[model samples]
Target chain A: MTDETMLEEDGHSGGVVKKFLYVNRRAPYGSIYALESLEVVLIGAAFEQDVSLLFLDDGVFQLKKGQDTAMTDMKNFSPTYRALEMYDVEKLYADRESIEQRGLTEDDLIVPVEVLSRDEIKDLMAQQDVVLSF
Target chain B: MKFSVLVNEGPYQHEASDSAYHFTKAALEKGHEIFRVFFYHDGVNNGTRLATPPQDDRNITQRWSALAEQHNLDLVVCVAAAQRRGIIDADEMKRHGKDANNIAPGFRISGLGQLIEAGIQADRLITFGD
Candidate 1:
């Protein structure tokens, strides 16, 4: 479900909803942080909180398409990104500068995410009630 | 003021757990209400009762349990993260058909909703991690 639908269903009508931003700043597979952060996001969705996912630095690689963990012997959980929508977590943002520095484009990602400039991303972060980074 | 603390790293291996513990202590001492302390990722390891550190060092798990007992603080370990890292309570042990449980005192295994709930209920949410 989308955030709009969630707002309508809850009849928010100006009710205060805490905005939580899960900041992903690490690469996937190299450590358990990325995968675990996603787990928290999935669980947080049940509370109907205003949730947004931010991908910055090496974290952007977590959403890259065609991840193969066969050689690394790690379970490839990248596909879970597509399921975020089912949990009403529709606000996905990626840092434009980070992507450009890595020589990647939005086309390289597996999900549809808004690529925001550094200043815009900072503004977004400032608006959140809570920011959890991993 | 109300505060929520998030521990993102385990004990011994990282200072995140210790930092969170001290921070919680100071907050409570200053008359702040701790809504919850949500342990995630490696942080879930802090809830395990099986850790046996050197005699000269501090027992992190015991310290947390004691602090919680004194203040009635909510210490929650993420169930999914705990299950993955072999941290289980009596109920989970029975349900999963495991031999024994290793969750320490003053801590409970719960879902991720608790973390979000902490954020919503508290005036400030502080995270300590690597």
Candidate 2:
């Protein structure tokens, strides 16, 4: 379908704002995927799209507090998670199983996030127009 | 059908790029319209023209360029991801005061908005990654 027709069919011919869900499955610092995904989320917030972030697997560690990269020579960007609220991108979901597996509680994170079960997260993922994983 | 593809891995190192390429080609062969291909993370490396693979093997960058040229596809490399990985276009090179640029043909540098836009505009947004 053409772009115009797709927008028109959605009844938002003026502009279609899609639901974008970013799935974070990697740990921070080990690779650049986690940090780069955040960059996309931050930039995507500017578009005024319906955006949600999901933390699964080792991605739960990204929200953990007191992340020190002093010896790694990489800038610790964990503080940026707090600023997500200012961007109006507040829907942060952390998998309960992942947290429990890693022996972490909600109190350990730098910012507050909704802890959901795998099934609940699956339902949320189904509702998204786009699911981008990193 | 309209399709939007996302590639998250670099060339040679992973099969994500190759898989995305084949999927896109197959979709096009079946008369599907490609809304855009957003290269994120190491996938941005696919947009560099400096890759010099051996002559015997498939040149992934050239394959993408050729497909884009044949189909007039929109290949977008995320600016934020590209900058961190040293993949810059002429404008970004000037803005960042870099010595040169290596962005491949048929690929443009843009923000994450293009990706969101693609998801909105396309009927399907398929991602190939680890």
Q: After superposition, how far is residue A101 of candidate 2 from its true place, in Å?
A: 1.1
Over A46-109, each residue of candidate 1 has an lDDT whose tens digit, in order, gives: 6677899999999999999999999989989999999999989999999999899999999999
Tens digits of per-residue lDDT for model 1, B1-130: 9999999899988898999999999999999999999998889999998899999999999999999999999999988778888999998898889999999999998777677778888899999986
Per-model DockQ: 0.41, 0.36
Local accuracy by lDDT, each model: 0.88, 0.87
Scored by lDDT, the top model is 1
- Model 1 bad stretches (over 4 Å): A1-16
TM-scores of all candidate predictions against the true structure:
0.92, 0.91
- In candidate 1, position B89 carries an lDDT of 97
Give me the runs in candidate 2 sitting further than 4 Å from their true place: A1-14
CAPRI quality level assigned to candidate 2 from its DockQ score: acceptable
